[model samples]
Target chain A: MSVDQFLQYLISGITQGSIYALVALGFTIIYAVTRVINFAQGEFVMLGGMLSFLLISSFGIPLIPSLILAVLFTAIIGAIIYLLAIRTAKKASVVSLIIITIGVSIFIRGFTREFLGVDSVRPPFFTGDESLTIFGALIRPQALWIIGTTIVVTIILHLFLSRTMMGNALKASAISTRAAAMVGIDSRVMALTAFVIAAVIGSIGGAVMAPLVLTSYNVGVMLGLKGFVSASIGGFKSPIISVIGGITIGVIESLAVGINWGPFTSSYKDAIAIVALLIILLIRSGRLALEERAD
Target chain B: MFGFVKNKWIYFLVGALLAVMVLIPFDWFMGKYNTLLIFIGLNTMVTVGLCLLMGYTGQVSLGQAAYYGIGAYISAILSKTYGVNPWLAMLIAAIVTGAFAYGIGYLIFRLKGNYLAMATLGLGLIIWILFRQLSEITGGPDGMGGIPYLSIGGFGFYTTFKRYYLVWFFCLALLLISQNIVRSRTGRALRAIHGSEDAAESIGINVAQFKVKIFALSAVFASIAGSLFVHHLRFVSPQPFGFLASVKLVVMAVIGGLASIWGAIFGAATTNILSDELLLGFGELDTIVYGLILMLVMIFMPQGLFVKLKEIIVQWRSKTTQKV
Candidate 1:
């Protein structure tokens, strides 16, 4: 492909990647604190999109206030799930906790379907009817919004974790819960905080991407799995790596689709993410083994 | 002596229940819709296998449907493309599916917990994508049709009643085999692994070998069910074995009470029938209902319907004894 065509694909991929990064950040935040993979993280995104759709279309709210309200609403729901399901299964086995989260995901999916009705709803774009042409590649103004918002969120998160006492406590709990507790940190509160932060970021992601993907009840599963895969690919170790991983996946997928390899390429786009996940995971495992042997 | 009587009586009761189920189509419920019940019976076969792998072995698989799809496609291709006998084609499908499962299990068994789940999920999705993309072989998204009906004893089983009987027989056979497996030494090993893999390993259980065996066994069951479904419907489509369908299979195992062999059948039948009834009326909201049921069941009754039933029965017996 030409430079312009490649740039066009790259820009679009970055836009999609930002959303995945936001979602992956949510997964990372929750996992870091609770040691539980919050499978319902993706549903929070769906809730954000669906709520935004409702606020803008039905209630005639402005985009900024609607976005705020949606994010807050999703955060509350995430906190409630943490309280009801995750807390009750705290002492249970890891498998039990995983099942509980899976259960929570299903419950949210069902509730959304019932509340939103059967049809898909679209949220109004952050930017109104504006497209930017850069180096012979056209980019939507909303794409910039997605990318910008992701960067802002990442910076804010970095500050929150580094500069704030509560953030440090949360990180302390993640690193060593017993040590954090001995130092007077409330691990429970930290977990709840992580859930809230994750939920808000996920909701923001959902609101931003709704215009591009449309808001549907069942969108959570694919989004959640992709986000989880992104987190894993980045070693689930650092937020910066997570964002890079998400964007890389999005760009590769978009280019794969753009190139049009064969007859079933379009349908296999979703499968590409899964295959990438498997390859990355196996490679990571192999590397871990090699390092162990070296030691 | 009482224990012996109870064991024999349990077998007798199970046999009687199967006999009654087999005779249901021949009775007044011979409607075309009873054929749907037969399909449910086929699903129960696959679900039982899933319960064994997921429930007893404590290994989550999202690729049960892949095996099911493989079996259906294999049977369809064999029967349609090569003019193979239907019975032989199904047998071949089961074996091929088992072999494929062994290969996949070898790779996936290395990962544990969420990683394993994701890996299986990816495998299912890959198979589904292949099924959709490979039009020349799988007929693409539209699905492969024109599969000939299965027959035995020089008589074609074209009618719903005959097909019902055919599927019922297989289901019964599978149930017996699954029950035997679950009550055997291998079953104990699986349960041990589920309880504590480290402990199971220290105690001389070859954890990987047990996992691989159960996975292959589960795949075989799923494959047989798929073969039955294709032979009955005379069509095989990728949609029936997608990621969503695999999730539904897992849901069935969980909802039905995973530890029991019969739970799979019960879960599959209830969910499948409920989905059919609700989806016809409520449109896409049926998915919501499915999700809600799964969530509620896991939250409130993680032990599942079978365990709940057992609890109730125990309570009832205690109350009766106290009254006496």
Candidate 2:
């Protein structure tokens, strides 16, 4: 690829990666605390975009306030999901828990489609749609917003986990719920907090990225799967690794479009993510066997 | 023979099945419920295998659709394009699907619980994408058609009436074989694994091998169902054979009481009716109801709707006996 083409692909890849990172962060948080993959994480992202669109265009709210409200509303929905679905079925098996989350995802998508219509909608861009020419490659200001927000969120998450008492307690609960409880940390509360925080991050990602890729109700299904793939790349452990996985997937997908074999095109682009998921899972299983042998 | 009633329930079920088979040739039975019965048969074929896997082996698969699609597409492509016999095509598809399942089962069965589910889900999605993307072969999203039907001698199973009987014949035979397995050593080993994999392992059971075998068996079952379905519809598409279809198969297994072989019949019949009759009107809203049903059943009665209903029937029967 030429320099300009590489830069163009690079810019779009990062832009997509930022969204994946946010969704992966959500997946990581929930899995870390509850050992449950909140499959509805991407739905929160969808809600962020859809709710913002509703607020700004139909509900007559300004752009800035609508964005904040949309994120907050989605987080509240996340909390409700935790309280209603997850809390009541505490003793359920692993299979049931996964099904419950999938059910919740479908329910959200169903309602969104019923209420919001199936059309793709985008919020007004944060900065006007002015394309900047850099080394003969065009870049949108919204791309910068996405990249900047991801960096800011990553740093904030790092400081919160390492420095703040609540964050540390959350981390502690994730490590050892029994020990944390002995230290007077309520694991239940911590679990709920994880969902809320994850939802907030996901919704922010959705709302911000909306202007770039138009949002729809069914968008969550693919996005959520991609995010799950990304988090799995980290083995659902480190935040930084998850972010890298997200970016890698993003770049691979964009590059799939740039380089074309006659048969494989953008149509099979999503398969790249699915392929990545399978490869990561196979690698993990292999590592698991090696560790067991070592043990 | 008169004194030998090892299981009264089995006798009753056998009698009922016989009656249905006899009545199926009649217009009264075949005219109104022909397609419905065909779908129920197809679903039962898949769900029974799932029962053996989930109910007996205690593993979950959210990607049965991948195998189902494989069976359908393989049969469709071979019979339609290459002039292969439909029956032969189906047999080849089942074997191919089973082998595919065994190969992936090695990589996936190593991961327990949620990770395993994710792996299967990815596998299912990948196949669905291939169905849509490989346009030259699969006809892309529009799917492939003009597939020939299975036949015996010179008599083709083309009509809904003939197909219904043929489908149910296979479905019932599979059910019986599965139930027989549940009584045999292999079935006992499966239950032992489900009770506790580690305990089963310590007792000299080959856990990995058993799990992979059951996974492959379930894939074969799903493949058979897919073949029957495509031949029945005379077209094969990626739409029906996707993640949601796999989920629906699981739902059938769950609602039918996963542990019981007969429950697959009840679950498939009820769910097919719900989708065919109820969803035909509401369209997109069917998902909302389907999701609610899945959550409600899993939460309130994890043992499944069929099992709970059986319990109630037994309770009421005991009360009547007390009156006597």
| Model 2 C-alpha lDDT per residue in residues B150-182, reported as the tens digit of each score | 888999997888888899888988899898989
Model 1 per-residue lDDT tens digits across residues A50-162:
99999989999998899999999999998998887777667755555666677678778877777787578778778785798998999998888889989999999999989
Question: Which numbered prediction scores highest in lDDT against the true structure?
Answer: 2
Q: Considering only chain A, what is the TM-score of each predicted structure?
A: 0.95, 0.96
Native contacts conserved, per model: 0.41, 0.51
Distance (Å) between predicted and true CA of A47, model 2? 1.9
lDDT for A250 in candidate 1 is 83
What's model 1's interface RMSD, roughly to a tenth of an angstrom?
2.8
TM-score of model 2 relative to the true fold?
0.95
Native-to-model Cα distance after best TM-score fit, residue A235 in candidate 1, in Å: 3.1
Candidate 2 residues lying further than 4 Å off, grouped into runs, are A262-264, A286-295, B1-6
Question: Which portions of model 1 show Cα errors greater than 4 Å?
Answer: A117-121, A262-264, A286-295, B29-33, B278-280
Backbone clash pairs for candidate 1 read none
- Cα lDDT, all candidates: 0.83, 0.87
